[model samples]
Target: MTLTAILPTLRASLPEPVDPALWPAHTETTTDDVLVAAVSMVRLAELTGTPCVHTAEQAPPRYRPRSWMPRDVSVAVASVLRVRRPRTGVVLLELDAVLPPFAVLDQVRLIGRVSTAAPTRTSVVTPYDGTDGEPFHRLPAPLPADVREGDLLCFPCVSAIRHRDVVEPVRAEVSR
Candidate 1:
């Protein structure tokens, strides 16, 4: 079925609105392997009705020891106000606020197969420190998917903690 036909079902499956203030802070890590971090951030804004910020930090090469002094930078902050699937394999995401140094909107065209499977569970992990791991929440199942973008992708809003390692899961429903 087309995305339009399945939108209502997807919307109905969303968990009851949680108080944004009560929601824990979330952070997402970006790398060449996952270029869709922004998409997840946008989804987080949509779910929480809050602005999400994209930041970057300079760290030593992979597998290297943590730098005693790291520099963290803010790339952008924005919120996803609207999402439209004008046609198959294309999506237009609208944003409310976009900080300097980045475009305000994103148009994604799916060039590969998309997944539609339901997620087993959903949660957010905070920045890790030597002491305790970040807080985590097990979200509802059947998470929404952006079929137009070719995957069942879900982005949860998170608060960025110290410049430590933070890994957030953006799971696809299934492999095409």
Candidate 2:
């Protein structure tokens, strides 16, 4: 389906506005990258119903139908776990933890660092944290040789989740 047709469904599925504390800090970057990341965020939001925010500048010129966009457009862009590009290696890792919705980004950070490549460049596909008692979704069939599964991982909870330093190890069900 066209993006316009898909947008409404995406917006409707998203959870409540993402907590500001969990929002990624926007740094000065090229418009093209921002646009790509914005679109990626939108797709991710559509899948998980996790709220994401992107700046006006990041909005793609071609995606003109703004009415159906997800909420909190004014907040900083959500952190990109990885960007898929030719010749760039991409890894998908499942986050296994009952993370608060806001901690998703932090979990992304942690998985990025521990993976074979840098988190900034690697794609991390986190599992639905068990908060909703959702059954773990399996990684795509015919997984890559580089992809690892059933690996335990951990990272510090975002400050919003706890005032003190709480080192938590979230099990990463899959890694690529």
Candidate 3:
């Protein structure tokens, strides 16, 4: 089956405006592969919502291949806000915020309701290089402001931490 068959008129396709750099080329797939991924994505979409689920499925297949990181996955806390012209409001979450780990970045899927009546463009925080072992991350341009603060944003990491090296823990010693 072709991609058109598997996608079957996706409601929320990937964001087309972000720099080409944010997303990698989709892994070459056979009809069977697309079907499998599509099926999995459908289930995921049902749980999350149409937009997020569609974005997850469109991500390069290689990004989500089953894998584990040496260090545990952690997230940084920050409120979503509106940025300047290029940047829109998105959750500026840092993964492995304190420590660096090893693994590939996973795809991010976002879900939100219409905050504004008009259609607005959107963007999200994606790693600079998803293939790299470093933890440094960056945000894409022109994220949609349509989503309110409470909306959920789910997507893969822009990149992953390395699994080979040991991450040093940051322990705060308190003296009484």
Candidate 4:
């Protein structure tokens, strides 16, 4: 399988131009159908650097044919969860894909954060509202020890454990 074959498959999954807000309520007939729909929709959203909505201004650039890892899929993962803004953080991991006929669109990129060894553990640090007086609030439980800097942590709508990645320099592009 090549990356070229996957590009069209991803695009084919896009929801027609409409309001993205309705996505959550939209239903697919089967689990397999839903998975393909979800992956394509989410990946498109990430490519455009836009929040996933029923209708988006522009379609994401096509993905170029290449072997994509779980990391490559992280940007889309975060884009999918941008609304939730996981205060706890996420870890994106790439799963296995057999060589198959895939379509090539554009290269996938990852948005990640830079961390210093001092911080050591991956934890969510919430800024405190002045109204409450506290300067900052830290969430309990740090991300897994294995999670390192530059790793893509995607939080999809479904299972939290379903993470993937690409082998590249993952740059952190935290949304405002």
Residue-by-residue lDDT tens digits, candidate 1, 53-119: 4454433333546545444433233333455555643334443332222221121111122233332
| Candidate 2 lDDT, 1-176, residue by residue in tens | 22312342332233212223334333221211222233443343345432233332222334457564432222212233232343545444443333344333332211111223222233444444466654432222211223344332222222234211122345778977
TM-score of 3: 0.28
In angstroms, the error of model 2 at 169 is 18
Lowest lDDT 10-residue stretch of candidate 3: 27-36
Worst 10 residues of 2 by lDDT: 109-118
lDDT of 1: 0.31
Over all chains combined, what TM-score does candidate 2 have?
Answer: 0.23
Global CA lDDT computed for model 2:
0.31
lDDT of 3 by residue, 1-176 (tens): 22332342332442212222233233222211122223343334346432321222223333454662322221111223333334543334433222223212232223332121222334333345445654434433222334454444333323432321212244588999
- Candidate 4 lDDT over residue span 1-176, tens digit each: 22222332332333212222222233221211222244444344446433222221222334634653222121122221212223434432221111111201121212233221121123332233246643322322232333433243322221111122222224588998
CA lDDT of every candidate: 0.31, 0.31, 0.31, 0.27
Worst 10 residues of 1 by lDDT: 102-111
Candidate 4 RMSD to the real structure: 18.5
Task: Candidate 2: list runs displaced more than 4 Å.
Answer: 1-88, 104-120, 126-147, 159-176
